[model samples]
Target: MEKTDFDTLIERSKNIRTAYHQLELQHHGSKWTIEEDTLAFLTDAGLVGRNTMSQQGRWPKTETDAELKHKLGECVWWLTVIADRMNIDIKDAVEHFLTKTENLLEK
Candidate 1:
């Protein structure tokens, strides 16, 4: 198998979601706005945090390792998708994020 780079991941993720949303548009006659989709992903990110707590025994051991990894992957996937929707490359976003955080940390 060919090694998948970040660019491939971004393309594959975008293609999969485009197909999914096409189906949603066909049957539901609607798709969520970018803000709505971002909020939905934010909710999923929160679930990942909750799962972390559960695994740590802070609440309950409810999340398996695979499940936790899946949610975390989904969070990254959604972030890439949102960045594409906003016309930015995920690589650029990552660079911008690191630069901003480093500058903030130096303050």
Candidate 2:
């Protein structure tokens, strides 16, 4: 079966996260808990927000465009990882959210 881009993204994110977990086990003697993963996601999200503010001239101009873009991508990666950890299908969740929001907006 052909894989959609999102499917590829999900697989890749899971693979990379699993690899990182292994690395954590080696270096730290344990992998992160789901709560720690959530915290890490929030940390990345905060960086994304800071970069956005920098872009909008609302914060110190500390990050480059590339940095901002990378942070944005990292946020998506975190969301995918978090969803998978929670047994939620990220694609379906996003689809439902968009559909419901669109329907509401059209009303």
Candidate 3:
């Protein structure tokens, strides 16, 4: 497997979100409010959890790793979408979170 940088991953994720939005934008007719987006993001996150369970054979909804992997990717899409809509960078957010957390623990 090849490794990708965070920027590339974020960019690719944003591109996919754009493509998907193009398909459904007309139906939504406008962007959702932050609250709505947050709910949607959480829903996507729950789906990811379910996909993880499936991958682990814990009452799986999906029959294959491929399906689970696709769901996992969809979760990443939600993460990127939520961050984009909220005017945040996921890479920066995670890095800042980790640095803060580790520093706090060390002190």
Candidate achieving the largest lDDT? 2
lDDT digits (tens) for residues 35-103 of candidate 1: 977997999899898888888888667646778899998998899889888898889879999999999
Please list the residue runs of candidate 2 whose C-alpha ends up more than 4 Å from where it truly belongs after superposition. 1-4
Model 3 quality (TM-score): 0.71
Q: Where does candidate 1 clash, by residue pair?
A: none
* Arranged by lDDT, best first: 2, 1, 3
For residues 2-58, what per-residue lDDT tens digits would candidate 3 score against the true structure?
Answer: 997878888887787677667667787764666776787778677767777877888
lDDT of 2 by residue, 13-104 (tens): 99999999999999999999899999999998898888888888999786568898988988899999999999999999999999999999
lDDT of each: 0.87, 0.92, 0.76
Whole-structure CA lDDT of model 2: 0.92
Candidate 3 positional error at 63, Å: 2.4
How displaced is residue 47 in candidate 2, in Å?
A: 0.8
Superposed model 3: Cα runs more than 4 Å off: 32-34, 60-64
**Poorly placed runs, candidate 1 (over 4 Å):** 1-3, 100-107
